[model samples]
Target: MTAPTLTETLPARETARSWWGDAWLVMTRELTPTLRDPFSVVFGLVQPLVFLGLFGPLLAGSVGATVPGGDVWAWFVPGILVMTTLFGTSTTGANLLFEMQTGAHERLLVTPLARSAQLVGRAGKEMAPVVAQSLLVVLVMLPFGFAPHPLGVLAGLVLLAVFGVGVGSLSYALAIAVRQQDWMFWAVQQTLLFPLLILSGMLLPLETGPRWMQVAADANPLRYVVDAERALFAGDLASATVAWGAVAAALTAALGLVVGVRTLSRSTR
Candidate 1:
């Protein structure tokens, strides 16, 4: 028995599905592998968990005073969630790269699905893993004396999903841009990822840093999101921090989606 081709799996033109329905189909196809191999999700989690275990304790001991409520878990855990979003969503393009190599991307391009749906569907899948990792991190920290407000944490997850969608879309755009030379994808990703992480203060507070560093952080959108996550996780939902974070997340999502869709459309043309 032979495997079904991309067109065989996609909805037929006679089906008359909306753009969202088409996107759903692409998302389900993209997610099928991750669903079948649960270990991949766990494996993807190792780095964030390790950072939580190792760097978290050191952060608490060293600069616990700088953290809100002087509770490091409250501050650190949300940052880890953002970190999970960053690392997890940023590398999603690698899978697209593999698809390109295998001619799977080309096959999908020739299908009747909307081009934007391909990018939207692919980026949408990023939310699930980040949600799982965020919940797991919260659960793991609870035993260690970490507690978050229920409603606030739920809101934080919504923000995280919005942010993840944007970052994931940008990553896919990068993948399409560098499809001709595979190594370039990794090169650009690594070069930009750490700077953004450090500037965003995911592992540590940046308040005591030099004025220049603080100014740089102020410009980084990720910083606002992290601040919002901290406030939300700490159950302070009605803060200026949360408002700024929501704005940043919304902007990033908008930009990432536009770039991703345009790139995919141009590449296929």
Candidate 2:
């Protein structure tokens, strides 16, 4: 009897297309769960508003008149947007952990879905809500006299979305690697969420902070995000701040995607 021939694998192009399709399906399914949770959506929408309204006025007098082109509340608005995105994205990992515990992740792995597609889809689904939250922050900021250059505002929003997806992916990966839903939930808040917020220049300018803190902020991608937002609001599109911010956001996304997939694969195995 003749030896059996081995089957040839699909080309990379075809593989990528297949993965993309699977990702889309998963993304759609994931969205349904979020949509059904009206309380989640409502809370996500309201919290940012509360933060902006409460804090904006409180600090306006102190930082508003002191900083260059201050309008402290306006400057703080972008930070709130970033904060909203970060919180919204970070919590997504908890759901992923739940799925893993419930055997949903195992089912997904046994299917023909590409690992990357599954990871991207999960992160993307979380991103949609973040984008909505960020936009609502912008609207809330408008009446407070925060005006971004129209085109720059659009660019900043796009960057924020990309950044959120990346950070969220990273958080999901951490959650998976830990494999404890409650622990992941707390860790996301303690490890990733709070550090990024405090170091990111959200509440205050980096220049005004202590030397070591400023250095740390400089190294933080979140700082760049706030810088980009600040530049957009000032109508200074060509500034180095926005350019660096975009670069940092892109790098974070790329690195996070890689780490997330690896973590998910190992966990599944």
Candidate 3:
């Protein structure tokens, strides 16, 4: 047979490419703006740093006693990392909203890129900023007694990335759903954010809360994430908490991607 034409070969080549490769390509494209304005990444760390400094000391006695090894920093730092992950990823949809408003999303749709790759890439892009901020939080707290288990911290980052992907994907889906009504996006985001944060016990332990509050925390997936982070940072990799956290993160990532990919497909079509 004659050699396939370039146009004929291109579709095959793209189809042969792995999903992750497509996702990586999309992630790199999404990261270009962040690279140009590196300051934004640094700015994102400010809130977590403030929480680390201000709230950490306050948890010394009460919360400290509850933590493993009696080190409050060990407990607080991981929660801060989770907090950073949650906040950073949860708002990523606004970027998509901006793109939608400018017709950039439309331009992207006309490209050969798979729509799922677009969602995965945008969601995966949040990992870099969250990881940078996490490392900074670790270093900043290191001298102050936040001793991390090297392997555990690495695993924790993996878990955090998974969770971030889920949160970011959901945000993008939400943006697509409310594309015509911008105020609804903000309203729903804010409405859900604080409840999740508080219920997750990132800033404080939920054990001391009343029965109803404790019951609510049990249902919050974030609570498991925070617990896993704390356990992982303390070098408890094999603990049931970490396993449950992994399950929770995996489920969230799966759900978000399913919902996001579906929403994106429906919208574009």
User: Which is the leading candidate under lDDT?
Assistant: 1
Point out where model 3 deviates above 4 Å: 1-20, 61-63, 66-69
Ranking by lDDT: 1, 3, 2
> Alpha-carbon error at 126 in model 2, in Å?
2.7
Residue-by-residue lDDT tens digits, candidate 2, 44-91: 867778877777777776676775576676578778888888877877
The alpha-carbon lDDT assigned to residue 171 of candidate 2 equals 81
Whichever of 1 and 3 has more lDDT, that candidate is 1
Candidates 1 and 3, the one with greater TM-score: 1
Q: Write the per-residue lDDT of candidate 3 for residues 103-184, one digit (tens) a residue.
A: 9999988887788888889888988887877877787887886689999989999999999999999999999999999778
| lDDT of every predicted structure (CA atoms) | 0.90, 0.78, 0.88
| 2 against 3, candidate with superior lDDT | 3
Off by over 4 Å in 2: 1-17, 37-39, 180-185
Error of 1 at 215 (Å): 0.4
TM-score of each: 0.93, 0.87, 0.92
Error of 3 at 62 (Å): 5.4
Better of 1 and 2 by lDDT: 1
Give candidate 2's root-mean-square deviation (CA, Å). 4.5
The CA-based lDDT of model 1 is what? 0.90
- Model 3 pairs in collision: none
